[model samples]
Target: MRYADRLAELDSCMLSDALDNLGLPGAVAGITPIWQGARMAGRAVTMRTVPFDGRRSTRHLGAAALERAVDGEIIVVEQVRPEGAPPAAATWGGLLARAAVHRGVGGVVVDGACRDVDEIRELRLPLSARAVVPFTARGRFVEAAVGEPVTIGGVTVEEGDFVLADGSGVVFIPAERVDEVLAVADRLAAKEAVMAVALEEGAQPSEVLGRTYEEMLHDR
Candidate 1:
């Protein structure tokens, strides 16, 4: 199966453990779905929005990324700020959600903040953002680059990287490491399933989650 197809079957926590087992750094920190039950997995199309430099342009924030990305891909927005500046402006909003929906993109992942939560929720476009605010990016931030490596949620996510974002959190997988990561995650998931079945059979909780569970990562 394709990477995106395979990743869609797994959640962030499983992918996190897989990364840990492989000594990789892809567990995104402080990023979660803005709405409950929202999940997305696809290749990453990265973009960066930095604090404005006292100038303005006709281009809209995140527009370039939307145009550059193909269907079923995720646009990752990395919000950069001036030194000692606060993350106040919103890089994503309702209009973008509507566009994403029409474009058939997987969803959006924002390293900073997003606005228009109500509209986005109504639109039902899955979005994962670090924060939410009413402030607009106008005159505060500008699109700096598209299709580049970006540091999002403290993780260095590159273009074309596999991304899985769900309730637990967002986890990015390097394009080169997807096979190994998927193999490890699949094993861990299988074991966890057995443990769940044992629990349902009235097995002792502690016994089901004992040293064996603790050392499952290194067992491979």
Candidate 2:
């Protein structure tokens, strides 16, 4: 199925709640900031590491490997930085972003940084990362590992885990929990849709959202 179609079927809010249930950290905040443009839906290509040191590098993915990527597979790179030290350099940049989009790669979810913010926003491909920088990985880093487990934001993602990111944030649905998580997310989305319709129909804010949402959503 198309990634956008799959995303269209699920509830973004429910997906957020499911991540909370899973105890994953980065899904809620800065690490997974959603890039505007195309929505991403795909299996993960996981990698594990810490701190994006410029000294560590991988051969830029060659054409053959790039061609291997399809609709729902993300380039999941990780950085394992020490408590006090920060990520070394921007792990992704404009060329990489364009290349990923060209290959029909679903998106990129980095445990570090990205560059060329305006250009990436224009490309409209899905990208989630820690921050943006003009300086990027050139001779510094290469693919440490592919199709291996990687940690991002505080989540351990195994290869082929179902990945989703949107306005709410990014979440990793372990292969084991995909069914249940999708189900709950669908329910939450359905209710939110109804609430949206009612609000448009002139329902008062308090009546549409009610005390539960007003209190619980804010408290969290």
Candidate 3:
């Protein structure tokens, strides 16, 4: 099955555990879905932007990314800022959300702030971001590059990598490791299924789930 299809069947926490079992690092931290029950999986189209220089243009920060994205692709934006400083402005908003919806794009993942939360929610476009603010990017940031690797929440996401986001969090699966990761996740899901049934029968989670963590990692 296609990784995208398989990914749609799993959640972020399941994928995270699979990555951990395989010794891979792709769990993005401090980023949460903008709406409850929002979930998305797609190939990534990366964009890296920097705090706007006094004289540089800030036109079309997200427009370029939308144009470059194909159907079912996610735009991953990484805002460049000074160390230990907050983002100067929101890099995403309702306009971009509408464009993405029109283009059939899966969703957007922003490493910085995003505005127009109400509009984005109404549009029903899945969004995951670190923060939300009303500041505009017009004079605060500029697109530095597109189709380049970006670090979101300490996870390096490259163009074409598989991005899966849900209520738990967001995770990036390396393009080359998708098959292996999915295979492991499938097995883990099976084991967890057994535990789930046991739990419904009044079994203790600590005894059934916790005790099998390491055993399942090494099983099969």
Which is the leading candidate under TM-score?
A: 1
Worst 10 residues of 1 by lDDT: 80-89
What is the total number of backbone clashes in candidate 3?
1
Q: Give the per-residue lDDT of model 2 (tens digit) for 1-220.
A: 5444565566345677655544543253455554554456677777654433465443553233345566658777775566655666677777877887777787877777777877778877688887777665654445556667777666788877777765566677777777666655665566678898999999999888888655432332
- Compose the digit string of candidate 1's lDDT tens values, residues 1-220: 8789999999999999999999999998678889999999999999999888976677898888999889899999999975545578999998888999999989999988999999998988999998899999998889998998999766899999999999888999999999999999999999999999999999999999999998998866
| lDDT of candidate 1 at residue 116, scale 0 to 100 | 96
TM-scores of the candidates in the order shown: 0.96, 0.76, 0.94
* Native-to-model Cα distance after best TM-score fit, residue 189 in candidate 1, in Å: 0.2
Cα distance off (Å), candidate 1, residue 72: 0.8
Residue-level lDDT of model 3, residues 1-220, one tens digit each, is 7677789999999999899889899998778888777789989999998877776664689888899999989999999888889866999998889999999999999989999999999999999988899998887888999999998877889999999999878999999999999999999999889988999999887888685665777664
Output the lDDT of residue 12, model 2. 46
Better model by lDDT: candidate 2 vs candidate 3: 3
Candidate 3: the clashing residue pairs are 52-141
Cα TM-score of candidate 3: 0.94
> Which regions of candidate 1 are displaced past 4 Å?
82-86
Indicate the TM-score of model 1: 0.96
Worst 10 residues of 3 by lDDT: 211-220
Displacement of the residue 125 alpha carbon in candidate 2, Å: 2.8
Question: By TM-score, highest first, what's the ranking?
Answer: 1, 3, 2
C-alpha lDDT of all candidate models, in order: 0.91, 0.65, 0.89
